[model samples]
Structure formats: structure tokens, C-alpha cells
Target chain A: MDRSCVSSRRAFLAALAVAPLSFLVQPDKAWAADGQPITKPIPSTGEPLPVVGMGTWISFNVGGDPVARDARTDVLRAFFAAGGGMIDSSPMYGTAEAVVGSCLARLDRPEGLFSATKVWTSSTAEGLEQIATSERLWGLQRLDLLQVHNLLNWQGHLQTLSAMKADGTVRTIGVTTSHGRRHAELAQILETQPIDFVQLTYNIADRDVEARLLPLAAERGIAVIANRPFQGGSLIDRVKRHPLPGWAREIDCTDWSQVLLKFIVSHPAVTCAIPATSRVDHMEQNMAAARGDMPDAALRRRMAADVAAL
Target chain B: MDLLSYSLVDLIPFSRETYFRLFERYNIGVWPAPIIGLAMGLTALFTARRADGWVLRAPFLLTAACWIWVGWVFQIHWYAPLSWPGIYFGMGFVLQGVLMAVVLGWGPILGSPEATDRNHGPGLWILLFALALQPLLGLLSGRPWYGLEVFGSAPDPTALATLGLLLMIRHPLRWLLSIIPLAWCLISGATLWVLSVPTWPVMPLAVVLYLGVIVWPWVSGRSQLE
Candidate 1:
């Protein structure tokens, strides 16, 4: 056997030995050895990113409200405590980037943070300015990833992002589109653009990307970040109205949100799922989704069918 | 750029909780403004009911100041941080204030006997509703009393009260003055509707009622020949 394979097997055995005690101590440690988070390699550079990341959309746009700011700090604390890595935001999300910066400042800027933001301006020159603004607002010397938000002026912004990536101003460059908008164009960009990641709206209910964009990302060695994993809380809301299926235990899902999250990240092509939430409890549930048994292809099909039936 | 691709929820970036907290912090940060605004609204109401001739312009002047205050202070300084479109909303409000000041406050046409006719029907009731009742609606949503959206202070009730005051006046240019207030009513209604607030329909419903009341006098042939 290969040496790396032997090492992996030894790690697996060590995890098996600690599994029962870890489960008794903290359920999140049962799957991964030493309670480390489950991570997926970014295909471009093979950096391990936690499969579940938090998105600061409406959740972090509190806008100078001190009470709400502290409350959001608690949410971030809960997220980092549960082994979260990437935190994605955009200028278009109003004060979300600023609020995230404030909360991270309050938290002393966690080392595990994978600071991801976007350049949303239509002007190519303005894209550089926006990236600077994002870095300043994030209170970071350099951002880990910068995406072209919603593919707005994707061509210009992507060129700028490519240059930024080349000069080491930003580590990773990506493009994003949500609400399943402009997938054909997104696919073309993924085919041609030398990008690191592509974010798109993907949930159990909305699988339009499954037909083409997802596979293309895999083939092109692009990391896929699934936005709206719960379809902006509506999918989980609708699904929660129905009782959890008995078979949900097969993947160790305790709630509809975990099940929904598990379904998204379980896909082989998907690199991560960014779910935005305001509550600490919800953050814990989302992070928990990254730790447990992920659904297989057969279970994924059943999960989708069951959710669709609901 | 693809405007059609967006939904109502996409336009409202903040949650309903944050929005309510906005008013709470605004009300606290600009303390006594809400009280003074309510006082100005009451003064306008009294002037509209009891005074006539040049005194009639008091309500228009007061309403104009309220619009300007809300545009600059509340919308620009407070709400704009939460949503960028608030800057446009503030500019619209400032323009509305200037228009009200120019057309209804100082214009000779507004003080005319025909223009001063008191609309004692639904118009007065609507004005009263905007003054005393609209602020209470926030309580229904379980918001703290400090977060109550008040007239001359908050945009929704300010716009509604402007529409109510416009309904009372009979000037030909009243429709011209009604344009921004009406537009604000619809815009705010859509915003609140997207926020899923229970009182979402109140502003739009006020618009409907204002238009219906304006047309009813003409529809019933109640207008006298000029």
C-alpha cells in the first residue's frame, strides 16, 4: 500500500478508537479525529476549507445598531467556535461587510477565518476601489477570496480579479451569480476564465445548476460555493412544516436545515455551502451539518425526492 | 442591471428586526425630535380645522418641514446606511418638501377661498388616523413603544399625513403636490410589504382612499362652477 494511504488508514483507525468517547463528549467530534472540522480541498490550490461557511447577507447588515452588533458578534463567536472558516460578504449587502469587520474586530479576528468578499461595481477601475474598500471594511491586510458579485460586469471585474490574483493581492479569484440567473453565461465564464471559485444559488428545490454548471466547475478544477443553500430560509421554512423523514437519521440530521445543508455539500462537485443566519442556534446547527455523515448519491436522490414531495 | 431578475425580498437587505431597531435608535439618537414633530403635526391639524386665509399655510409649512427633516435626518442620516436607495428616497423627500413650500405654502393660488374649503368628510378622519392612530400600529407588531413610527418623524406616517392634508385642500395644484406623497406611499407600501409587516397595506390603502375621496366629489357632481 502507498505510504499516504497507510497514514490515512492509521488516522481512520485512530478516529474509530476515539469515536465513542468523542461522541459522548461532543457529538461534532464523532466523525473527524481530534474534533477537527470536515473540510474540502479547493481544487485550484488544494487548500482545505470547511465545507460549511457562513454568509453575511441580510443577517449581518445591522447598520450601526450597537445592540444588534453585539448580538451578531455572538453569532460569529458561535460560528468560529463550531469550526467555521469562510465568511462571505459583498458591498451590495449594505453594511454587512462593515458589520462583519466590527464583529471580527470584537472577536480579535479569528485565525481560522477565510475572509471572502466581492467586487460589485460595474466600472473596471471602480472594481479595484471596491476591492480596497472591502479589505478596509473587513479590517484585513489582504482578503482570501474576492468574487465578482452576481456576475455584474463579470468580464471587467474578472480581468481585474485575475490581475489581483497574479500579483498576490488576493489569494483566490471567483465569480458569483444567484437566483439561478445567467447560468449559461456563467458556464461560459467557468469554461474560459481562469477562476478559482463559482458561487450560485443551489438548494434541494433549485437544482438547475446540476444540469450543466456544477459538472463544468468540477471538470475545470473550480471550487463551487453553493449560495442560498436553504433558498434564503424559505426552503427550510417550507420543509420544516413537514415532519423529518425517518431516513434522515441515515445521515445523522436532527433538523431540516442540517438535512438541507447535507444534501447541498454532499454533491461531489460542490466545495462548500454558504448559509446565512442571524441566530447562534442556527449557526450551531449549520456548522453541525459539516461534521456528520454526508449523504451518498442514492441518499441524495432520496433526500431531494422527499424534500420535493414535502 | 437585470432589474426583472430581482424580487421584492432582494430589495430589502435588512431584516424586519433591524428595521425596527433603526427607528428605535433613530428615536433615541434624535431625542425630542419625535415629540416636536408630533407637536408640529398637532399644530397643523388645529390650524387646518380652526384657522383660515394665510393661517391655512401653517399646515403646509409644517408638513414641508417634516418632509425635509425626515428626508435629511431620518432617511439620509439614519436609514441610508441600511439601504443605498434611501439616498434617492431622501432626495425625493427633500424635493417634496421644497415643492410643498413653493406650491402650497407661498403660492397665491393656495390661499384662495375655493382652495381653503375644509374637507370635513373622510379627509379629516384620515388626518386624525395618521396623527393619533398610525403610530400605534407598531405596537401591534410587538415593537417597543420607542420604535413607534410617528408623523413628521417617520416617513410612512409623514407621507400618509401629507396625503391626508392634501385631501382637505381643494386647489387645482393639490394634485401636483400629491405626486411625491403618493409616490412615497406606494414606495413605502412596497417596502413594508416586502418586509412582511402586517401594516404593509395601510399606506397604499390610504392612497386609494385619498384618490377615491378626491374623485367622489367630482363623480357625484358636487363641485361648484368656478
Candidate 2:
């Protein structure tokens, strides 16, 4: 190896050695206790949100099955117990919003619960009805955030969401896309629209947003919610076959999920990463990602490289 | 929205466990329906084997009843909540039931010599599989026996059995009757495949088998003589 490469490797290892001690001496101010999750400020309102939120895409769409609904309720219980905040869903996710409402009703609606869903209809009038249905399904008087799901008729829905936000029907309005679709259009919206948040897919394996979208969000003062932190669970499944990298210890990651999540929220613009899970153990592991030491810029690059190499 | 952009995983928004639990709940909620459905399926299988004139219409009527039952009771009431597409699926199934009744049961083709010829071939085997073996495929994945999907009550085996029944008959309108069942075979196959179920191939395999059975006699130059 080159002399400079060897010295850099040694310095990296040295940093890894004292990473946990650094957390104890000068912990990330966002995390108060040893195990409490870390929080990030929403750029639009300066409100603090835990970096790890829950996504209810498939996990909570259990329909009317009592067994499955109760199981999802357990997952949500574990989430709130672990200091989870945002619970993101969509009308497109069929029965998920209702299931969340059922679970919240079961839990009596926990404190610190931040409800986020989307409007996913083409007609502007239907979008308003859909939002009302979402509120009814979620059993909430007002939703904390509403996004134009997959940017379907975003032009019309954004106008409706903006009006809703203005009249205090909704707390925040935004737009979302997944599978890296339509970033160019999303960028145009970010530049022109007055939105509170812009959600897109971002993870260690998928980082196309870093080049432009993340920077644009940072510059435009928009909170960015990173979806598909696990590429809908395929990424973690693929990486789990390999051993956890030795440097994962530096960031207090016991499993590959935390390593992937920390890599996402460590980004300067990412406000939160929503990883969907049906199992309570997985939810607990997901929430744990928000605590302890976060990877720095150099370590973040290395983490991405190591995961990609895996 | 670009419908083609979505993958199978993106379309199916529930786990395999939840899917299996759907059948269990359906089977329990509609208690005597599964029993009646299986009995009707067996009667259809028996009547299909005889292939006697006018008597063959019994199978069509029985299978038609099964389709309507599964469509409304299972698909619309039970499965639609889990997947919004179930509403369309139920509509297709109900249409298939009505088509079978009007075309096969009441049409002039039931008494024709072509429709009466006994088809004790792959068609019988596939029907028997749908009735007796398809539900057992769930056992391979460690699903509970109560959750076993059966014909007349669940969509998968019901669709499969419909294809199998179509294969046994020889009429001009059989293709029209096969449309919804064939489409359902693909849809259910994709759903099971996305859920990572071990028995995912059963539905798609039925499609290939249905197509293969229809094409094989022609490929061997036997259809011309028939």
C-alpha cells in the first residue's frame, strides 16, 4: 500500500477505537440519554423529529384480520416505546391508514406521534375527498404531514395541500416519489413550490439524490424524508449474508440495518429515514439506529463503499 | 402513473403470512361454504368425467355457482380490503360465472358431440390437482391446515379448477370462458411470487399446463382427426 493510504487507514482505525468514548464525553446533542434516539430539526419549522420513523407500506396493510391487526399494533407499540415519532403512510397503501388508526386507537394515540400520509388521486376534487378520508381512516382531526404520493397529479394536489396547510387543516405539505423515479421533475417542484418537505428514496446502495436533490433540499430549506432505506428490505437481506464490517462498531451498529439507516440520516439534508417492518424486534432494531455515534463525512463515504462492496 | 414501472413487490403490499391468514379467516367466517364448494367441485369433476349429453351441463352450472360464490363471498367481501384490485377481480370472476352459465349451461353447444367427448387426460389430472393437491401446497410452506386454500371458497384453486374444467370441454366458447380464469392465474401467481410463498409456481404452472394441454394434441397432429 502507499504510505499515505497506510497512514489514513491507521487514522481511521484510531477514530473507530475511541468512537464510543466520544459518544459518552460529547454525545450528539440531539440524543439526550445513552439509548434515546437522535432527532433532526425540520428545516421549515425548526421542529425536532426522530431520524428513524416507521413506514407502513405493506407491514401495516393487514386489512381486517384481527390476528394481523393485533400483530401490527404490537409493532407500533414497540415503535413508540423506542421514542419513534413519524408514522408515514399513504391512501395508496390500501387499509394501512385504517390499520394505523386502529392501532393508535388501541394505544390511545401515544404522545410524540407524528402522523404523515399522502393524497394519491388524479382529480383535484378527489384529492380533497381522499385527504378527508385519510383523516377519517387515521382517526385524526388533522394530519401532521400530507404529500402528493408518487407525484401523481402533483400540480393539482400541491395546490390543494398548500391551501389545506394555510387553513390549518394540515400541518405540513410535501411531495414524494420512490424507486428513483422523476427526480428531474421533483427538483423543479422543489425550486418553484413552497413545500415543507420533499421525500425521496435514499440509502447506502441508492444515492443518486446526493449529487443534486440533497444539495437542492438543503439549499431550498426543505426537510427531506429518506424512504426505502433498506430498498424495501432487499438491500438489508442482501448485505446480511456478508459479515458486518468491522468499522460498523465505530458507529455503534450491531446489525446491518442500523449501519444502513445511520448512513442515510448522517447525510446533511436527510431529516428522517422510514424503514417499514412487521416484526417488533425489527422495529426496535430500526429505532436503535437513531442513537449513539453517527458516521462523519469521511466515515459516511467509507460506509457506503463498504456496503456497495459487500 | 406509469403502471409498467411498478414491480410485483410494489403491487403486493402484504406478507405471505398475512395472505395465508386471509384464507384461514375466510374459511372460518364462511364455515359451510368451503364444504359446499368442495362437494360441488367434486360433483363437477364427476359430471365432467362422464361427458354425457345434457348431463354435462350439470358441471357448468355447478362450476358457475362456485365462481359466483368465490367472487362475491371471498373476493369482494374478504380479499378486497387487503387489496383494492380485489374489487375488479371479483367483478371478473362474477362475469366468468355468468358467462359459463349463459354459454355452457344454456347454449346449444352442451349437447354437441364435440362437447360430449370424454377427456380423461391432463384435464382430469389438473382438476384433481386443484381440488385435492393445490390446497396442500400451502402445507409445504408450514401454513396451518385450517388456512389451506380450497376450491369454491378461495380464488387460487377455484381459478385453477376453472382452467382445468375448460381444458376438459371442447367448444368454441371455451376460450372466452378461460379468459378471466387465465388472467386470475397470472395475477394470483404474481401475488404469491411476490410474497415469497413456496407454492407461487402452482398458479403459473397451471397456466402453462392449460396452454400446453390445449396445444399438445394439435402439435401431435391429433386435433385434425378429432
Candidate 3:
């Protein structure tokens, strides 16, 4: 074309050459090694929460109230320190909601404390009432997500929730189903609703969500939240007895918890997996799972097969 | 209420004669409680001058309550009754109410950030309280807890009633309610000289525990801890 156009193209290539060298000296601020939130955007409202989060199920399973609450505080502190925002709790977990609330209040609020709790009541009004109570317990301005605990009072809760969504009292809404009991139903709901996110039991041992749910969520543009990444102590039970495979290091996955977590999160539809842990060390490993070089579908299947064979 | 001690034919499902007799004994007029509650809620909304969009919540609340009772009795267990298809499709419905109220309207329903009482709070709680009568009377009527026993072998009505009472109490009033019936039922059920019955009937602590959970906050203040 013209001489100036030729010179412009050369200058652009020179700039690209310098950009790679600048990257060698400086890394992008968007992410840490965990591949967690460089930044997260709420699918419903375009709000972003950090991809790293904490799960409060069996992890905070301390028998005594004090121990459980303190343990949760440490776990939560670790999550926030590591740039985590979402904290998933449920009425099913007994004192988990209370303890999580206690911890959040005790800490005087962390910057990234995006609270998500479930309502496991039987009736619609009761469910709504619990949601109100949970908000008060946590002392947050608003919750990031409110799921139905194990799908108790599912339809009634949803109808009521639709009005709330229209009113804008809550920011985002999602559903959570643990175990493989209602995958088909969960899929159907995802198919129907304009759901922002879904939380399901998924791990290397239980990658069944990958075959259908994950794919459907991807297609429907719904974000996925994975729970039971340790299969609520199954992965640790299985792999704990076995050694970490040699290939674990290829993806920065060093522990069984990290390995299992990494596999679930490797799915593109997966927004994040809330792995519960009472121990700060376990929380560290869990947060690490959000990091670099996640396995692709092929590798995830291989990981599944390996866990199966084990 | 008199209980039937089982004989050798115990393992089989209840006979038709017994089913008819048991059905009459339980006399489940409570089934319509939720329906009536819905009608009243709708009526209340109609009568009120300022109650605007809040009126629409009645159907959803009534339906969820009905299903909760239905689901509880369907599988016959105290924990979340896992009916085959009901458990499947019900997840969305449950989460929807939770997300909606918490995300959207928890404040107005709870009577705002202040202690000022709201008009609809009592109506909503009373409508929900009507739902508790079914399980309460179910235990009180002393029907042979059959497919109803959903929990175990023999029926223990006292525990169920006590559970109902505890649940009916507001969050702060929890200490005021008595579990004498719950304790007596369990102790009697455990100690009573049944020749050889296996597991006891459904006590339903969790089910009632859940009821207490949802209802308590609504009755007293907007929360449980206080």
C-alpha cells in the first residue's frame, strides 16, 4: 500500500516485541497463581466476586460451639486474605450459619466477604423468614447469593424469590443440590430459569455433573458453583490412602484436595468450587486449587478415570 | 390415645379394614389448614387499603407450606422426605423463596430496620402457624404412625407435639416452651413394654426442628439470637 502504512506495521511489530519483554519483567495484576478472581462478574447483575470461596459443611464439623466458631474464623480469615469473597453455608449444616455469622461479625467485616447462605425451610413464608434471619445473623448489607438448602421448599421459595428479584432487595439468586439425587431435576430447572448460578456436588470421583450439568450450564450461560469437591471427605478418603499421581505437579496441584478441586474447576462453566475446611492449612490448599494451568476436559476425564481406577 | 401392639402379621402393609379405621381416627381436617390460610391471606390483602404487591405472596407461601407437609408425610420420614420426583423438581422452588425474600423483600417482611411492627407480619406468621396443626394433631390423634410412621416402627405422639410447641414459640421465646411431651414420648416409647417391636415410630425431631427454625424468628423479632 503506502510507505506510511508499511512503517506503521513495522512499528506495531516492534511494540509487540517490547510487550513480551515487559511481561517477562511484570505479571498481569488480574490474577494470582490460583486462577481465582482476577475479577468475577455476577451473571445476573454484572457484579464481580472473587472466584475463591469457602464452603461450610463438614469442614466446620467441630463438636463444640467455641471450637467450631473459632475454626470457621480462621478458615474465613484465610479465604479473605487470599482474595476470596463468597462464603457458602446452609441451614442443613446446623450451626454453620450462626458460626459463619459469628465469624463475619467478629472479624469486623472483610473487604471481600460476599456471603451466600441457604434457606432450608418447609413453607414459602418460613423460607423467606429464614432468609431474613440469615441476613441479620451475618450482619451484611446484602447477600451475594441465597440458595435453597438441599432443595427444601423449592417451588414455593422460587415463586416468592421472583418477586424479590424484581424488587432488588437481593443481588443474585442461585440453587444448590448436593449428592447426585436430583441431577435430572436440577438440569431441568437450569433449562427453565434465568438462574445466575448453580452449586452441585462435584469432584474427581463425582464428575457426573461434567457430562450434562456443566455442559448445559455453559450453553445456557449459567455460572457453576461446585460443592463437595472432596466429596465431603470421600476424595481424601480415596486419595488420602493413595499417593498423589506424579503428573499433579504439571498443573500446580500438589495435594489430593487440590487435585480434586482443580479437576472440578477445570470446567469452563465452573465459576468456583466452595471446598469446606475447618483447618487453615486445608483452606490454603483449597485456595491454591484456584490457581494456574487448570486441566482441560481431556485431562479432567483422565483424572476421573485415574480416581475411578484407584 | 390407645396404641395397637403388633402381632406376627406386622411386617405387611396395614390391612384395608385397619386403614379405614386409622384414617377415620386421624381424621385429617388439618389438610385444608394451609388452603384456608391462603384464602384468609388473600382476604386480608383485599381488605387492606395500602397492602399492594405484598398480596401476591400468599399463593406461593400457601403452596410451599402444603408441599412441605405433603413431602414430610409422603416418604413418611422426619428429615426432608425424598419422594422420587418431588425431591427432583422441588430444588428450584425451595431456593427461589429463599433467594427472593433475602435478596428482595426480607426487610419489609421483618418490619423494617426498626422495632416498629408491620401489619402483615402477624397475618403471615398466623397463616404459617396453621400449617403446624397437622403434625401436632397427627401426633395428638394417636393414629398408628404407618406409611405415616415414616420414621420408625411405632408412633410416639408426644415428641411430635412438643416439637410443634417448640417450633411455634418465637426465636427468643424458645426457652419458655416445654419439651415435656417430647421427652415423655421418647422415654415412654423407649421404655414401654412392647413384647417385641423393632424400631420405634417416627419421632420427627428434625422436621419439627426445621419448623422451629423458620417460625421462631417471625414470631418474636425479625431474628433468632435476640
Candidate 4:
């Protein structure tokens, strides 16, 4: 049995058993590799949010690992460097809000941060606590936008959010649902409730939002933040193996990511398209969607048909 | 179970990158753990077919060690802080380790490989492949070499080695030993599948292999013949 080998290995293992954790070291800040800014106003407040913003869904839920935290810092650097704002997160995303805070704390430039997060709980009290916790986690004195996540206990939470807005704890109040869930209810709420914004999933493949929700938001003068613009990265993977269409250049889309992103933001009702990404290169690609020649109503139809065909 | 309330909001709160980074960080922090793990896996492979000897104890001992390492190092220390469900997973791995210990330490299970259903050739092959080729899965998936998941330090290979070891053991008790590893394969596999990982199918394949090894000898009357 190589007792000496076992003993030495055991010693090494014990040493490692107590070793300090390796958090992501801060990397050299990279410049945003894209051009220009595209701004759209919140219909209620008339406050402008760049059409290309950041979402912290799966991409930003990196827990407390410093290495992952530092990597996201670089992504944020690329985002803000490209004139991006209106970064969004949720309490349901585990430590994502905290990770976003950690990244923000390390960022050299955070003045343009339009911090947005959700109150994701079942009660008014819990929602209040969660909202306060989210603010603490994000290191913000006041949240820029607060939405009821997925409409879970939405009516109860909306009252709290409405109060928060009136009390100046949050600048904007809204409701959110994704994967096309609860659109009827969302549209009804937008009609009846005093919401400033509506966050929901809207992309090339998932177009149910186009018929009703988009039109309703426009009609009600509610700002729209489009999420899952890449359809949870699945749509990007679907078109990645195929070559970009020659017409993609007409919309200033360099890749399938931008092509998908530009399609969503091109909608006149969409105040912003928050495409979540961890890679700085992908961030640059997403931010570039804001600058290029946007697709017109006619070309947007062609973009949808092309991706649908693939 | 309410179909009306069902939605696609993920129960697991981390992304695929975060999950992979957990393995990467675990493997990196342990440094030479994989080197020692390979030796332990090879030790299990060489000693698995032995009947009524000290050598027969190697596989279970190594399996228990791997399970405990995954329990404490990977699940508890690494994953638990990330999500609340990881605490349950950590406890599950520790429970598996304790169960293996009870079976190996006190019961008439140690060094008692029965001849009834043992297939030395395939058993050795499965054990070696889990220890050797399984670690390369990270590299094949375009991750760096440091992302290699090894038997003594990772969940998938440890569960796989447990199955391979069970293949050389006797009936009823062998069935008992297969429960945890098989259950983990199904669970971990589903999680990976949801995360869109390529190796997701491998767990279900392992479950099929384990079921075949356990049931084939009985159905064919090979156990009666022995």
C-alpha cells in the first residue's frame, strides 16, 4: 500500500483543507469596445434609460465568489463604458443583487448606474424587508426601479411599491412577468394600476408581447423594459451555427447576439432591452446594438422571419 | 403539483458558469487531489474482484473517502453558501459516506466479494474509465485542464466509482449500496440538463448500466447457477 505516499498526500490534503479561498482577482479594466448611446425615456417620469441595458438573471447570479465577482465587474465596466445604464436584478436570483453590489463597489465609474431590482416575496411586510435587503445588498440609498417579480403576490406588493415611490424610496414602480406568463393580468394591471414601467420577456421568437402588452404599455404611457431578449441564450445558440444574413449589416448587427438584441430594442414601445452577459466581449456586442442603424417596422418583420426560419 | 401555478423560474439560483466555476475552484484549491485520486481509483480497480481479503476493502474505503470529500469540501464549503438547497445536498453526501462506513466497518461486508454476480472485466473497465476518462470531460467541453473532475474529489466520478464497486459485490447488500449513487446520478443529471450541459445524458446512462448489472444476473438465472 505505499504508506509514505498516502501519508504525504494526506498531509497535502490537510494543508489544502484550510487554505484561504481564491476570490476572483480584480482584472485590468477593459474599455467598452462598442460605439454610441441610444436613449429612451420613461413615459411616466420622462427619465431616459439607454435602450441597451444590463439584466442580472442567470448571468449575474454568481454568488459571493470574488473571482466571478471581479469578472462581472469587467462586464459592468464594458457596459457603463459604452454609455449603458438601467442595470436590473431580482431577489430570487440568490446572491445576484449582492454580487452586483460587490461589483459596483469595485467599479471606478458608477454614477450612471440606474439600479433596478425586484421585491420577490409573498407579503407586504416580507416585500418591504426584501426591498430594504435588496437596497442594502446593492449598496444604494434609493433604488432606481422596483418591480413585483412575476406577479407573485403582486397586488399586495404593488401597494407597497406605490407607497415607496410616493415616499421617494424608489424612483419608479412597476410589475414584471417573464416566459410570457400572466400577460393578461399584467396588461390589466397596467390599465388599472399606477405603474410607471412594465418589465417582461420580449424577443424575436417569443412575440406574444407584441400583440397586446407592447401596445398596452404604449397606450398607457408605461415604460417597457424587455428581458430575455436572447430568449435565455437559447435563441443565440440556435442561430450561432448559421452565418449572419447579409442584411444584418443594414441594422448594424455584427453577430447573432446584437441581431437578436436590436430586434427587441427596435420596437418603439421598448424603453430598453436588458440582455444579461458575463463576458466583456459579449457585453460589447450587446451594447453595440444600441448604436447601429436600428431596424424599421418593415425590417423588424424580416428579422423575425429569418430567425424563425432558422 | 398544481399545474395552474407552474412556471419556469429556476429553483437553483446560480448560472451554469457559477456551477462550473465551483468545480474549477474546488479542483484548483485541492491542487494535487486528482493525482492522489487517480491512485485511489486504480487501487479500487485492482482490488475490486478479490474475495475475502484485505484488498477487497480498498474500493469501499476509497468510495467513502471520496463521498466525504465531496460532502465537506464541495457541497458544504463551496455550494452551501450559494443556495439553501446545497445544505441538504451536503448532508446527503455525508449520509452516503456514513452508510458506506457502517457497511464497510462493522457488517460482514468488508473483503467479502461474493462470486455469484461479479464480472471482473467490466467492473475493472467501469472503475478505470470513471477515474481516468471522466475527468477529461471538462477539457472536452472547452474548459481549462484545471477544471478536471476527479474521483476522490468530485461528485460524478465518485458516484460512478460507487456503481462500479457495487457491480463486484453480492446481491441484496449490493442493491442497498447502489441507492444513493443512482439517486444522485438522476438528480445531478437533471440539474445539468436544465443548465444545458452536454454531459447531462451521462448520468442516466450510468443508472441504466447499474440497473443492468444488478438485474441481468438474476433474470438470467446466473445467480441460481452460482
- For each of the candidates, give the backbone clash count: 0, 0, 23, 3
Write model 4 residue lDDT over B85-199, tens digit each, in one string. 5677888898888888767644576435453346665556677778888888877667777877888888898888888777766545666677889988987888788877898
Candidate of highest DockQ: 1
lDDT ranking, high to low: 1, 2, 4, 3
lDDT of 3 by residue, B26-143 (tens): 2332344334434543443333323335543333333334333433432133111111222422343244324333422334334332212233443333333333333333444354
Predicted candidate 1 versus true structure: per-residue lDDT over B71-115, tens digit per residue: 999989888888877898999999999989988888664537777
User: By summed lDDT, which 10 consecutive residues of candidate 2 chain B come out lowest?
Assistant: B1-10
List where candidate 1 sits over 4 angstroms from the true fold: A1-31, B218-226
> What is candidate 3's CA lDDT for residue B172?
32
Q: State each model's CA lDDT, in order.
A: 0.84, 0.84, 0.53, 0.77
TM-score of 2: 0.92
CA displacement after TM-score superposition, residue A66 of candidate 4 (Å): 5.2
- Location of the lowest summed lDDT over 10 successive residues in candidate 2 chain A: A1-10
Q: Which stretches of candidate 3 lie over 4 Å from their true place?
A: A1-41, A61-64, B1-226
DockQ of 1: 0.66
CAPRI accuracy category, model 4: incorrect
Error of 2 at A18 (Å): 30
Query: Residue A140 CA error for candidate 2 (Å)?
Result: 0.5
DockQ of each: 0.66, 0.57, 0.02, 0.23
Instruction: Please report how far candidate 2 places residue A142 from its true position, in Å.
Output: 0.4
TM-score of 1: 0.93
